[model samples]
Target: MAILIYTQNYDGKFKKSVFELVTYGAAVAKELGTEVTAVTTGKLDTETLKELGKYGAEKIITITNEELNDFSAQAYAYAIEQVAKKINADLIIFGNNPYGRAIAPRLSVKLNAGLAAGVTALPSSVSPFTVKKRVFSGKAFADVVIKSETKIITLNQNSYKVEENPVDISTEEFTAEIPEGAYAVKPIETVKSSGKMSVTDAEILVSGGRGLKGPENWGMIEEMAEILGAGTSCSRPVSDLDWRPHEEHVGQTGKVVAPNLYIAIGISGAIQHLAGVNGSKVMVVINTDPEAPFFEAADYGIIGDAFEVVPKLNEAFKKFKAEN
Candidate 1:
C-alpha cells in the first residue's frame, strides 16, 4: 500500500500549500515504509506535473476529463476515491483548505476510512495511527487515534514546513466515469478576482479593524499592504459596517488564514477573530488599547494610535527595503 496525496491545483498550477502537502505526505510515507503518490485533476503539461517529484511524489496521476475541470466536491471526491482504490492507498493526505474540507469527509465515507481533519503534525505513532489536531477552535489540542484499516488526514496550513526530497517520478492519466448526479449542483458562472493577492495564498497580510475609523481611511491599510507586498484583510466589525468587503474579513465567521506574518492594525482581538488567525507564524498587533485581547496572542504588540504608528512603520519598511 502507498500514501496518496491530493495535490489540488488552481488553473493548472500548483501552490505552496500543495508542495507542503506533498512534503508532509512524503514524511508520512517514509514513516510507514511506503512510496507516496500525488493525484490531481485538470489538464497540465508534463513539466508542471513533474514538480510534485521534487517533494517525493514517486508517481503522479492526473484525471483529465474535460467535465472535471469545474470543481464539484462530490465529483472530485469520487475521482480521488477511484484513484485510492486503484493504488490501494492505505493513507490519504490533503491540505486542510477549502477543497480538502469539502472532499476529505466524503472520500472517507466512500472508502470506509477514518478521517482526521485539521491535523497539525505527522502521526506520533504509526502503529496505532495517532495524530494531533487543534481543538476548541484553536484553543487546545487533541490526539486522535484512527483504528480503521484505511486512514485519511487533512494537514492544517503552515503546520508543516515544505521539504524537498527528489525522486524519479512517473505520470499517468485516469478517466473517471462520473455519474450524472455528480453535476446536480453545477456552477453556471465563475467570476475571477484580479489585481489583488488572495488572502488565503498570501504569506504576509496587513489587516485593519474598526479602529481605522472608516472606509475612507482604508487607503493607509492598502498602502501598507502594497509596500509590503502583502494581502489586505479586516476584522468582522469592519466588514459588518461595510468599511471593507466581507471577503477580506478574517475571523471564525470569515475565511481562515495562516500566513507567515499577520499585521493587525487597529483591530481589537476577539476570540472569534483569534481563532482564525492564531495559526499565523508571527502575529503583530497594533492598537491604542493596551488591554486589547489581541496583544496577548501577538508575537509583537504596539500600544499606539494606528494613524501615527502605521505611517512611521510604512516609512521604516520603505527605508529597509530601499537599503537592502
Candidate 2:
C-alpha cells in the first residue's frame, strides 16, 4: 500500500498548500511503512514537479493528456482513480479546496473508499486510522475513523505544517482512460490572477467588513495588505451588499480560512463569522466597539475607528518593513 497525494498547480506553479499536503502524506506514508507518490495533471515544468521531493514525494506521476489540462470533476476523478489503482494506494490525500471538493467525493465513490474531508490533524492512531476534523463550519472538532480498506482524506489548508525531507524524486508519464462527455461543460472564460496570493493560500490575511463603511474606503486596507504581503478578504455583509466579491467573503456561509495571522477590521465577531476563522493561529481585531465579539477571540484588539487606526497601522507597517 502506498500513500498517494494529488498535487494541484495554479498558473503553472504549485501553491504552498500542495507542499503541506505532501508533507502530511509523507508522514502518513512513513507510519504505514510505505512511500509517498505525488500525481499531478497539467502543463508544468519538470523542475517544478521535482520540488515535491523536498516534501518527501519519492516519485511524481505526470498526466500530460490535453483533456486533463482544465479541471473537470468527473474526468479528473477518473484519471486519479486510474493512478491510485495502478499504485495500489490505500491512502489518498487531497486539499480541502474547490478542486479537491469537486473530485474527491467522486473518486471516493468510484473506489469505494471511506472519505473524511476537512481533516485538521493527522491520524491519532493508525491502526484504527482515527483523524481529527472540523465540524459545524470549524466551530467544533470531531475524531473519525475510516473502517474501509481504502481511505481518502481532504486536508484543511494550513492545518498541517510543511517540512522539507529532500529526496531524489523520479518522474514518469502516465495515461488514463477519459470517460466520454467528461469535458462536456467547458469554461467560457478563465481569468487568472497575476502574482497575487489567493486568500486560501495566504499566510497572513487582512480582512475588512461593513465597518469600513463603504467599498471606496478600502484603500487603507489594500495598502496595509500590500505592505504586509497579505491577501485581502471581506465579511459576509460586505459581500452581501456587493461591496466586495463573494469569493472574498469568509463566514459560516462563505469560505473557511486558517491563516497564520488573520486581521479583522470593522467586523463584528458574529458566531457565524467566528466559526469560519476561529482556526487562525493568531487573530487581531480592530473595531470601534469595545464590546465587539471579535475581541474575545482575538489575540490582540484595537478599540478604535478603523479609518483612523488603519492608516496609522499601515504607516507603522511600512516603517517597520523598511527599518527591519
Candidate 3:
C-alpha cells in the first residue's frame, strides 16, 4: 500500500501548506516502507507539479475532469476516493485548510477511515498510529489514534518543516467517473484577494486591536507590516467596531492562525484572542499597560505606546533589512 497526499494548487501555484503535507507524508512513507504519491484536482504546469518531487512524492496524479473544477465537496470527495482506491493508498493526507477541511471529513466517511484533523506532529508511534494535535483552539494538545484500516489526517499549517530531497517525478492523468449529480451545488461567483498575504497563508502577521484607538491610525500598523513583509490582522473588538474587516479578525469567534511570527500591537490578549493565534511560533505583544493579559501569552513583551513604538520598530526593521 502507498501513502497518498492530496496536493492543492490555486491559480496554478501551490501554497506553502501543500509542501508541509508532502513533507509530513513523506516521513510517514519512509516509516511505512512505501513511496508517496500525490493526487491533485485541476490542470497545472508540468514544472509546478514536479515541485512535489523535492518533498519526496514519486508520482503525481492529476484528475482532469471539468466538473471537478468548481470545488463541490461531494464531487471532489468522489474523485479523490477513486484515486486513493486505484493506487491502494492506506494513508491519506491533506492540509488543514478550507479546501481540505471541507472535504476531509466527507472523504473519511466515504472511505470509512478514522480521521485526525488539525494534526500538529508526526506519529509518535506508528505501530498503533498516534498523532498529536491542538485542542480547545490551541490551548491544549491531545494525542489521537486512528484505528481504521485506512487512515486520514489533515495536518495543521507550519507544524511540519519542509526538507528538500529531490527525485525524478512522473505525472499521470486520470479521468474519474463522478457519480450522477455530484456537482449539485455550483458557486455563483468567487472574489479573489490580490497582492496581500492572506492571514492563514502568511508566515508573519502584524495585528492591532482597540489599543490603536481608531481605524484612522491603522497606517502605522500597515506601515510596519509592509516593512516586515507581514500580513495585517485585528482583534475581535476592532472588527466589531468595523475598524477592520471581519476577515482580518483573530479570536475564538474569528479565524485561527499559526504564522511563524505574530506581532500584536495595542491588543489586550483575551483568552478568546489568544485561543486563535497562540499557535504562532513566536509572539510579540506591544501595549502601554504593563499588566495587560496579552503579556502572559507573548514570547516577548514591550511596554510602550504602540504609536511611539511601531514607527521606531519599522525604521529599525528597514535598516536591518538594508544592511543584511
Lowest-sum lDDT 10-residue window in model 3: 190-199
Relative to the true structure, candidate 3 has a C-alpha RMSD (angstroms) of 1.0
The parts of candidate 3 lying over 4 Å away from their true place are none
lDDT tens readout by residue for model 2, 70-145: 7799999989999999999999999999989999999989999999999998899998989999988776899999
Predicted structure 3: lDDT: 0.91
lDDT, candidate 1, residue 74?
Answer: 86
Q: What is the lDDT of candidate 1?
A: 0.91
Candidates by TM-score, descending order: 3, 1, 2
Report the alpha-carbon TM-score of model 2 versus the true structure.
0.96
> Which pairs of residues collide in candidate 2?
none
